[model samples]
Target chain A: MQILFINNDGGGFADQIKIPDGTTVSDLFAQRMPGRNASHYLIRVNRQPVASDAVLQPGDRVSFTPTRIEGA
Target chain B: MRSASRALLRLAGKIHSRVESLQPTCSDLLLPDADWSRCRAAGRRLEKAERRGWRLAAVRLRRELRQAMEQLRLEMHRIEDRLTASERPPRIASLREILDDLRFLPDSFDEVRWDLRQEMLSVTTEPIVLEGFPLGRFTISLDWTRIGFTRPYHVLAREPNPAASDEAVTHPHVLNGKLCEGRGAVSLRAALESGRLVDFFTIVDRILHTYHRGSPHSPLSEWGGVCCPGCGDRLSEDDLTPCERCESVLCLGCLSGCPACRGLFCASCLEPCAECRVRTCRSCLSSGAGCGSADGSECFDGVEPCEGGRAQNRDSEADTHALLPV
Candidate 1:
C-alpha cells in the first residue's frame, strides 16, 4: 500500500511512500522519523488526529506536524 | 440551515479561486534556496584524505584515496551540474493538493476566513498557552497581495492577553500583531507561495505554542511583569523608570546623570555642553539665555561652561557662585 506522507518538520515535503498493508500509524512514524519521539509531533490521518496504533489505509494522507516550533 | 451551508461553500469556492490565481507565481515561488555547504565540506574532506595519502607514500593507501577522490569528484560533478532537482508538484497536482489543504480540517480548524473587503485571509487558532502563560487565541491574517513584498501576515491576539510588562507584545516573536517569523520565515514563505493553506496555518500555530526563553520579546516567566528595555533585567513597575525626555522604559542602572544639574535623564534627554562637551540636561546647559559667564561657561542654558566669568558679575564672586548648579 502507498500513502501520501506530509512531513511538516525538516524539508517540509509531501512524498508518497510504500507501506505494508497492515502498518499502523506508529509504525509509519517509526520508519520515516526514526529515533524522534512520536509525542513531539501531531500525527493526523486525512486531516483528523488519530491514535498511534491506527491502521494505515492505501491512499491515506498522513501528516506529522510538530506542535511546538520555537520563535525568536 | 441549508443556506448557511451554501454560504460556506460559496466562501470556500472564492478562496479556491484565490489559490488558483497563484498558479503563475508558484513556479518561481516553489524554487527552494540552493544549499552547497555540504558539497564544499565534502571537497575539503577529500583534500585532507589526499594529503594524508601523500604523507604515507603507500601505493595501496594512494589507490584507496584515488578511488575515494574519484567517487567524490563524480558526486561534485553532479552537484556542479545541479542534477539533483527536488520534486516540484506539477501545476495540476499543486492545484489539487492545495485546494484540499485550503478546505481540509474544517472541523478541527477554528476558522479559516476571507474578508472580501480587506482582501485578507485569516485563520483563527484555539486558545494557546505557552510555558503556563496564556497568550490567548490569535488570528493569522494574510494579505495575499503583499505576500512577497512585505511580510504579508499579522498574528493578532484575538483576546489580547498580552504580557503584563508590554501590552504591544502578545507573543515572544509578535509585537503589535506583527510576527518576527524568526526561523519560520522560509517555510512560511514557501507555504504561502505554494498555496498550502494548512501548512501556513500549522506553522503559525506552532510558533504560538512554543516559547524559547532566550529569544523571546518578553519571556513567559516575565509575562506578568515588565523588563527594563535598556538592560533587560526584570523589574517591578515601581522600580523601573522611563527616560524623562523620550519616555523610554528603562531600569535605574541605565540612567544617565547630568554633570551640571546632577539630575538623572536618559541619553536622549541630555545635551552636550558647548564648552566642556559634557552631556547635561537642557536646564543646566549654557545657552546664553540663562545668567552665566560672558564666554558662556557656567551657563545653565545647557551648553559648555565658558572660561570667562559672567560679564555682569566678574568682580562680584558671590553672584558667580550663585549661578553655579547646586
Candidate 2:
C-alpha cells in the first residue's frame, strides 16, 4: 500500500511511503513520529486525520502532526 | 455568553479528550496476524526462559509504556506553555524610545535569517550592527532541533546581530549581560543584544520610569537627563560638571554638599546635610563622621562608600543651602 504523509503546518515535514500488509495507523505513526514525542502527535489516516482508534490497511497514507498547526 | 470564552472552553474540552485517549489499553500495543503468529513461535522459544520467569519481560514492557507516557506529558506541557507565551507581549515592545529608534521591527524573520546565513559564510564578515551600535563578529548556526521541539511556531535562538557582536568582542567593556558606561538607555539596548533571555526587572524598570516621565504608553520618553553636577539644572559642559553617575544621567538638580563629609556631591551621591536637614552632595561631604550612603542610609557601623571627593565648606555652602526650599 502506498501511504502519503502530509504536514501542512508551517515548520512541518512530510513524506510518502509504501506499506506492507497489516500495518495499523498506530504502528505507522509510531514509526513516523520522533522518539518520545510520537504519542503527542496527531495521526491522520488517508486525507482525513483521525484519532489513534482509527486503523490502517494497505495503500493507506498516514500523516503525523503536532496538534497545533499554524496558518499564515 | 462571550464568544471568546465559549471558543476557549471548546478548545479545553478537545485538549482534555485528546489527553485522556493517549493512555494505552492492554490491546493497544498488540500486533495482528503474521506478527502475532511469529510472536507465538517466539514465545514458545522463550518458554524455557518464561519458566524461569516472564515477570522481567512484563515489567520491562510496562516500564517502557509508562516512560513513553511520561515523555508525552512533558511534551504536552511544553506545547501548552509555548502557545500561551505568545499571547503575552514581547517584553522588548515596552522599552522607551526603542521602537522610535528602530521604527518598525523587521516584518518577517526571513531577512534576518538570510543575513545571518550570509554573514556566517564570509570569512571576514564583521559583526552586524545592532541598535545603531556595533558588535564583534560571531558565527551563526541554525538550531533546527531546538526550534522543532521547544518553540515550533517561531525560530528562536541566542544568535547575536552582526554589529553588536563585533562591538562586544572588540570593546573590552561589554559582556553577554552587563552594560557599558554610556547613557545606559534604559538597558533596552543591552537586552536587545541579548537573545530572548532579557532581564525582566530591567525592562520593567524602564517601562515604569518611562511612564513616569510622560506618556505611560510611549517607549521614547524614558530618558534620565544629562544635567550638570554643579548648578542643579540640566548639565551643560560649557559651564557645568557633566559627570555621569551609576549609569544614569546626572542632572544639576541633585548636586550639592554633604554636611557631614562636606564633599562636592551630585544628588545621587549626596546625603541629607547634617547642619541643615536637606540632601547634600557626596562630593561636598566627608565619608565618616555621619554621612549616609548614596541611598541615604546612615551606616554608622563601618563600611565607607568607595571613591569619595574632598568636602567643600566654602561660601558655596550658603549658595548650596539657598537652592533647597526650606
Candidate 3:
C-alpha cells in the first residue's frame, strides 16, 4: 500500500511512500526517524490529528510537524 | 416741552445706544465690572426728571431701556450657540473617516494601505528586533467592518535572513506561519478608535517575545503562549495540544484523546464506550461501533450517548489507551 507523507522539517517536503498493510503511525515514525522522540512532533492523518496507534489506510495523507518550530 | 423733559429724553436715547453697542461684549456682562455705568446714570437722570414734572419723558426712557435689554439678551444667546458649536468634537461615522483623519502614520509602521472595496486595511510595520531571533517584519490586515465585531486582524511576519540552525518559520501567536491570537475584534477597534497604533504594535511584540522565551519541551508549548482555559495555568511555547473538535488550547492534563478514532478531545467532550473501555465520539458510535465488536448490542457509554440507549463516560483512566503524545 502507498500513502502520502509530508514532513514539515524543511521546505515542507511531501512525497508518496510504500508501506506494508496494517502499519500504524508510530511504526512509520520509527521507520522514518529512529532516534528522535515521537512526542517532539505532531502526527496527523489526512489533516486530522491521530494517535500514534492509529491504523493508517492506503492513500492516507500523513504529516509530521514539529511541536515547536523556531519562532520569534 | 420743559427743559428737564427734553434732557430726560436725550439721556434715554444715549442709554439705548450704549446698550446696543455692548451687544458684542455680552460675555463681559457676567464680569464684576462692565461698561454699564452710562445706562445706570441715564436711569438715575430719568427718575429725577419724573419727580420734577417730566413723567412722560421718564416713561419713554424706561421703554427704550427695556428694548435695548431685550436685544442684548438675544445677542448673548447667539454667542452661546456659536461657542457650543465650536466646542463639539468632530463626528466620525465610519472607520474610513477615522483613517482619513489621521495625518501621519505611527513610527512603528512602515506603510499603510487601504482597500475600499474589501473594507480592509493593511499595515506594514518596521523591522521588529527580538532577542535571539532574526529581524522580522510584520504585516497586519484589518477588516474595518468586522475589526471589533467578529475577530481581531490577521498578522503575518517575514524574516529577511532566517537563522541557519532552525529554518522552520515560527511565531509565538502563529500556527503554520499565521497569527492565531484568541483576541476579540473589540480590542482592535478600541486601539484604532483611541489612536493607539503604538499600543497595538506593543501587544504584537509582547506575544512574539513571550513565544521566543518559551521552551518547546514543556507541556505549555501547545498553548500558543496563552493561559490554559481550564486551570488558568500559563502556557509557554511548548507542545500544548488543542482540542481536535473545538480547537481550544489545552495543557497535557486537560487534553483527552478518543481510543476508537484516535482523535484528541477536550475534558468536556471526551466520551467512553460502554461495552469496550474505548473513548469514542458520538458520530463514531452512531455510525457503527468502531470497537470491532461483532454483536454491536448495548455498547453505550454515559459521557455522550448516541440516538439509541447508549451511554458514555468522560473517564480520565481511558487516557492509558489514548494515542496522544502526552
Given the true complex, what DockQ would model 1 score? 0.39
lDDT string, candidate 3, B173-291, tens digits: 45444453222112222333333333333344434444433222121223234677877765552335667778777877787656556677786666665545556666555666444
Indicate which candidate wins on lDDT.
1
Candidate 3 docking class: incorrect
Give the Cα error of residue A13 in candidate 1, in Å: 0.7
The candidate, 1 or 3, that scores higher on lDDT is: 1
Better of 1 and 2 by DockQ: 1
lDDT of 3: 0.49
Q: Number of the top candidate by DockQ?
A: 1
Give all TM-scores, in the order shown.
0.59, 0.24, 0.27
- Which 10-residue window in model 1 chain B sums to the lowest lDDT? B77-86
Candidate 3 regions with alpha-carbon error over 4 angstroms? A1-72, B1-97, B160-169, B176-189, B192-202, B209-326
lDDT (CA) for every model shown? Answer: 0.65, 0.34, 0.49
Interface Cα RMSD for candidate 1? 7.7
How many Å off is the CA of A46 in candidate 3? Answer: 52
Model 3: TM-score, first chain:
0.91
Q: Docking category for candidate 2?
A: incorrect
DockQ-based ranking, best first?
1, 2, 3
| Span of ten consecutive residues with least summed lDDT in model 3 chain B | B214-223
Ranking by TM-score: 1, 3, 2
